[model samples]
Target: MAEVKQDQVPQTVGFLEVILTGPRMSGFAGPAWPRTCTIYVAIADEVVAWQTLPFESDSDDFKKWRLGIRVPVASNWPDLSLDIFVERADFLFRRRTNMVVVTREGPHTSGHTAVISRARLRLLDALVLGDMDDEEEEKTMKRRRSEVMEGNPRLLEGTVPFGKAVKLQDWELPAPGDEHGSPRAVVRGRVDVRMNLRPAAFFG
Candidate 1:
């Protein structure tokens, strides 16, 4: 990979080709689960693209899906970790709890209202590009970043207990569950994804 010049803005950029294939469920098997799946891609905390796949069809070709996304070259390439999430169609925020607790003081009473909103992610993958100049430094930096991102310092305690933690950067949730560690009514399917990087100016 060639290093992009900082002073020059290229007329064209590179395209990140993502091929998601062979998604199958192991423990979950049923028709109640939505046959359609949604894919969300996020880079630098911003959602880049969203795609949906209709996997319920009996056709074999529908099992695989491909996406071509354009990405601009910038100095933050090393910090640009691409995150992908695959979820069922029914995946959305569910209100678990909503209540108000009243506390009385000497002369005044205050009520604290709390609301819980949650969602489940079927599969998640994070891809980080390494520095072409220094491989060792890139590895070290990745490890440190992984450690810091995985640490749950702001986790709260409530009706939803924390489940087994996984690495945020490079990890997959096969059967995503609620905050209480209980799996949702979604089917489980194995997803295979292949990513190919190419310059936008190239056509092959």
Candidate 2:
């Protein structure tokens, strides 16, 4: 193979990607589990993604169903938030949590009673380019003053925990409960994801 120059590598501007790297769900194979498994995550619009998983697992890893979503910026797109959640099973009840809301000003993971820190909001706003230059190409460097993340696309670089701790900018994500360490934890499993802009080497 011929050596490829840096300029030949591919890249993207105004991109939002989420990866379900390794999902370890805990449940019995009985009917108690949800009749269906659906990921109600809001991308450009309401997400209609559903998944069927084995209620019981013999191994510690349930990554058989991995996901990679890339949300692109379009002039006509209206929605500004990316909502993520799991549907409730018959035996399960609802729990209050913050909803990620985005707008021309900024993004925030907000709930009725509480709101996420401003620092965290900046992390999610990594790719929300309100006025991205339509003339610019993906491979070319961005020069717009409103460009998100000076250089990087502001994606969670490495395998980060998707549990209680939420830090997308920092790949580590402070896995205090690295192994389901939460004392009151009912669901016993781990989720490590790698959501990046993705280097061109990966496509190669």
Candidate 3:
């Protein structure tokens, strides 16, 4: 893991990509879905980070998800982490002639992992919200809801909890011209942090 100096922190407008994996139910059997997700850059003390919207039918093709976060230059911010959750519902069935039946399938075990950034840590009094400007909050809320209802139930929401400090492992760089062009001299790794999914008060 690379350690960054407090004075040398980069501006918070760079791109961040996140990868998510696990199993999901198909028409019958379950299968593995790997997805690559992206996020537009924004500044926040700590906000939700997801590979993509949770409800899309085609979301399984991605191997990772990208989140765009804007880190404040002057604020003291701690290293970053992730939170995840999954949603499930029950159903009822009818028998052949005149009988009715009901059944419940899940309470599915939704796995949560926190991706921790190994960069230098800063202690901030309060994290800043992203620039909303002319964007209405309702529009953003609708977009987020659509993602959750689409069947893909992995949702990255909630604030990060404090715990034992973890060290980020080193990741091998991709070959030249693979996707990021020639491999630059940058170190990369992610820490998977566990999260609780129950609803809490929103303090915005």
Candidate 4:
């Protein structure tokens, strides 16, 4: 875990933790004959703040690997999180190719969507010691029509609702344990997000 301060925060943050589920890969696996996976979390976009939790292989605590990411409420959007399983490890070792697969066998394929519930946020704040003071948080502005139009040719070519509010849903994945008491399978959860939408822009 890395410490982040308000003023000198890096543009991007990374988290390395054991993949309790998903696929097997090099450099991250449990002690039991290589039955798990490893994952990395990388986040950008300063306007929206995000956080992720690495899954723990030995604990029965379901909340250990959950994440909480904050988006501007002015956008009329909910806070969100994502659960990812590292199903495969792509390795380039001395010109040889090796890959490891980690998966959960059941009705759910180790992946599901999620909405960042209030409970989830509280749990995340405690885990990461996140500071959410109004004064400290940063807000981002909406992109100019020119910029949006320039970048997305489709928008200019068609009658797209550039500022429409899109409803987001929640998802979840599967987490399975092995005989040796290690988490060998994982599930995922996610929320839909419409970036850069502001309340004032939509209303007045």
Candidate 5:
């Protein structure tokens, strides 16, 4: 498992620990496998966390790999649900050759959705653990939106490319074990969120 910690912090900040494991490639019948996989974590449909995992073709080393990412949760966070998305970065779809089949029954088929991406959102618990009234919510929303926009102007300009991301509700609880690449298999993962209330020394 890979872990990272924040060092420069005099401000009050919470931590969201996300564990991604048991990634599998299913329903893909192509001769060439995906070269990489990217995971996106979202809150209220806005991306808050993104992690890319590059496949090591040598020895098929990524079959049992596990990734751990930490996201900082600040005060006045918006009230929303937590969502996760996984995309096959190197999925080959646009090709004249019938090299891949979408279904197992078919031998050779083309024109399959080239980019295979799946998503699952865990809404069993309220993502916004903080309590705030309408006025506070409005202030917090504006403040957070400003922060986000300041960090990435493209988001505010609506220049980022987005898709109709899919979300799976039942797959929140994945099956145990090392079934990373099973057909329609959900990745085994969990999220640990902790809240902090210390005062901020300086705004980043």
Candidate 6:
């Protein structure tokens, strides 16, 4: 096998964790549903990640999931985190990012959408944990996991890079038993893009 250099890739890769408020009837202003809603994170027509939210009556725990997003060099914009409804970032062709795929009468329908942006990455240092706190040796591995991302590009963001410039080894990473590559940043936000999810397309 050949070791591929991160620099030659045209897309940005990232791991995402989204905290959903609920299976609401509408937007954040909508009433929360007692059950769960299947959510997806996508770029262009590619559905990169998806999760069926779990409902809990015991606590106010919102749905959290970690997925990946790929941003091509074409749509590589610094302000990808801005709300999709904005005039500048506005997208009318089948709402993408942080969405719930469902069936509708026609290809056209009205809906609300929000994407989280400028989120802080939760730099995970195992030595920082209580179990691994006792280890005094040099940190072996390190990983960067995005926080609960909300808002809308479904608030999808990734490590900085433009055209094969992402070198994970050169990125900020250090910790034994920890692996790091192109650390990702995340936040708390929500998006509402309704569509249908066919598992065969993504899973196949």
**CA lDDT of each prediction against the hidden true structure:** 0.40, 0.36, 0.30, 0.27, 0.41, 0.28
lDDT tens readout by residue for model 1, 87-204: 4433223356553333332112123321111122221222332222257645654664454467523211110111111221212234455445643333234344444334444553
Report the number of clashing residue pairs per model: 4, 0, 24, 25, 3, 27
How far residue 37's Cα lies from its native spot in candidate 2, in Å, is 2.7
lDDT of 3: 0.30
Worst 10 residues of 6 by lDDT: 161-170
Top-TM-score candidate index = 1
Candidate 2: where is the Cα deviation over 4 Å?
1-13, 25-35, 59-61, 74-79, 89-190, 197-204
Candidate 4 lDDT score relative to the true structure: 0.27
Error of 3 at 17 (Å): 2.6
Tell me the spans in candidate 1 whose CA falls farther than 4 Å from its real position.
1-14, 30-33, 91-188, 199-204
lDDT of 6 by residue, 1-204 (tens): 988898766553332222223332222422332232344544333455555443342345443322333333222332232111110111234456755544332222234332222111112211122112223321321221122122113222432111111111112234455665444442222333211111122322
RMSD of 3: 18.7
| Per-model TM against the reference | 0.40, 0.36, 0.22, 0.19, 0.36, 0.24
Across 1-204, the per-residue lDDT of candidate 5 in tens digits comes to 855456544344444445554444433432123454466667667777666543442344555455555455554333335566554433344478855434422222233322234454332222322233368655764565465456643221211111121322223323578467444544332222222221232233
Report the poorest 10 consecutive residues by lDDT, candidate 3: 122-131
- Consecutive 10-residue window with the lowest summed lDDT within model 1: 155-164
lDDT, residue 1, model 2: 94
Which scores better on lDDT, 2 or 4?
A: 2
